[model samples]
Each structure stands twice: as C-alpha cells, then as structure tokens.
Target: MATDLVRAFVREDLKKSDVVAEVVSLVTVLEQEDFRKLLQEFVDGIDQSMLLDVHLLNGLVQLIRNAPQGYIDVDDLVKILGLLNTRLKDTHKQSTRHTYQLALTISQVLDSMVDSQVKGLSREQLHEPLSDYLEELKQDQDPYLVYQATYAY
Candidate 1:
C-alpha cells in the first residue's frame, strides 16, 4: 500500500513546491514501519536512464532524506543520484536547486549510515560519491551553490 501510494504520487502531476513536503511526510511514515523492501523494489524498478521531471525527482530526494537512516540501500541512492546528476542543468533552475538540496541531504544520509555502522555499503561506496560531489561543488561557478554544497558536507 505504501509503495503503491508513493508510486501514484510520483506518477501524478504535482505543483512544483508541493512535492517535497508530501514526500517527506510519506517517508517519515514509512520509516516508522521500517519499510525497506518496499522502497528497494520501487527504486530498483525505476529506470534511471530516463529524464525525470524535477517535481518527481524532488519528491524522491525528500523521500530518501526523511526515510530512516540506513533503511535505504546505498545502491539505490547511487542510482538515484546518477539520474539526478544527468538532469542537473541550468535550463531548469528550480530542479537544479532541488538537486543540490538532494546532494546535501544525501551527504547527511551517508553520514548517518556510517555513524550507525550499517553494513552493505563499503567505505569506497561512501567515499567515492563524497569526493565526486565535493569536486563538483568546487567546480561550480556559483559561490552560493558551492557554499550550500560544502555546508551540507
């Protein structure tokens, strides 16, 4: 039921700013239930190659962010981040901003996973993305963006 509801939300059309809050609420509820398998199945079924609309991706990021720490698999996070990176462009400013937000949230999530001593994600899995994202932040032309990215770390 949770998966179906979340998937429906992802499929439905939503106003730009509304997706994040709704998804965060849903994630919090799912976290209380410890719904790992449901999230895993949903994430695995998604096609990362396709261009995701910003609203949908924003909701996804929020979902991951608010979900219980270490509940979301590292592999799923990696795939979602890769898809988000592909969609990160200057053309859509809102999406780009949310993507940065996602990046920051991901850094926190990774830290929580490490602190909790979760297995399955190797140190390399955690470090590689951290380094790559840090590099990306450093190269960003916007000082504000770099600041946001670094502050997240």
Candidate 2:
C-alpha cells in the first residue's frame, strides 16, 4: 500500500518531495523486513535516465540518506555508487554547472553512507572506486569539482 502510494506520487507530473519524505518516514516505522523491502524497491527503481533530473535524483538521495543502517545491503550500495560514478563521468565531460552540483550531491551520499556505518560495507568496497573518482575530479578544469573532490578527500 505504501509502496503503491510512493510510486503514484513519483509518477505524478508535479511530484512533492515532502510527500515522499513523509512516506519514507512512515515506512521507517514498519517492521524491519518491510522497511528493507521499501528500501530495495527504491534502490531497484533507480535508472540512468533518472540521473539527469535533479528532482528525481534528490528524491532518491533523500531516501538513501534517511534509510536505516543494515537495511541498505552491499549490492544496493554498489548499484547506487556505480550509477553515480557513471553519471559523474558523463557530466564531467559536459563541463556544466550541473556537474558540480552532482559532485556535491554524490559526495553527500557517500558521506551519509559512511557516517551511517552501513552493516557489512567494507572499506575495500568503497575505497577503490571513491579514490578513482576523486582523483579524476581533481584533474578536472572545474574549480568547484576540484574543490569538492579535495573537500571530500
């Protein structure tokens, strides 16, 4: 029921972030299994097409940021990180303001994941890709991207 509502809300022409946040807050009160299911649904629903839309991206980021520890598994994190990495690479080539925004957003997501101390998330899983991404960012001509990369480091 809640998942259906969330889907409906997201499909609407005028999506409301507050509504989505409220739904997430409600889901967090559910039993652990149900909460995990919702998180899985949100993560699985993400796609490359959604990356360019800031509203949709923000919604997804909020969901991940608010998720309880242990609910977001290794595979889910890998998927999210992979998508962000791909988008970051593509956006960097374009060299638009959106690239910096995305970099900051991705940095926040990474920070949240690390700060949350997600269960079973090993340093090996996070370090290599993040290191590579940051290194790439440091080489970019965009001062914002370089600053973000340095700050993230």
Task: Indicate the worst ten consecutive residues by lDDT in candidate 2.
Answer: 41-50
**lDDT of each residue in 1-153, candidate 2, tens digit only:** 765665565465554557656666665555556666555545444453555655556656766776666666656666676676667666646665666766776787777767756455446756566677788778878788798887766
Candidate 1 lDDT over residue span 1-153, tens digit each: 656655665565443456445545667567444356434433443334254444444445556656676566666565554443434432254455655654554555455445545555444654465556666775576676677667655
TM-score of 1: 0.52
For all predicted structures, in order, the TM-scores are 0.52, 0.64
Model 2: how far residue 84 lies from native, Å? 0.6
Q: Compare the candidates by lDDT and give the number of the best one.
A: 2
Where is the poorest 10-residue window by lDDT in model 1? 82-91
C-alpha lDDT of candidate 2 relative to the true structure: 0.64
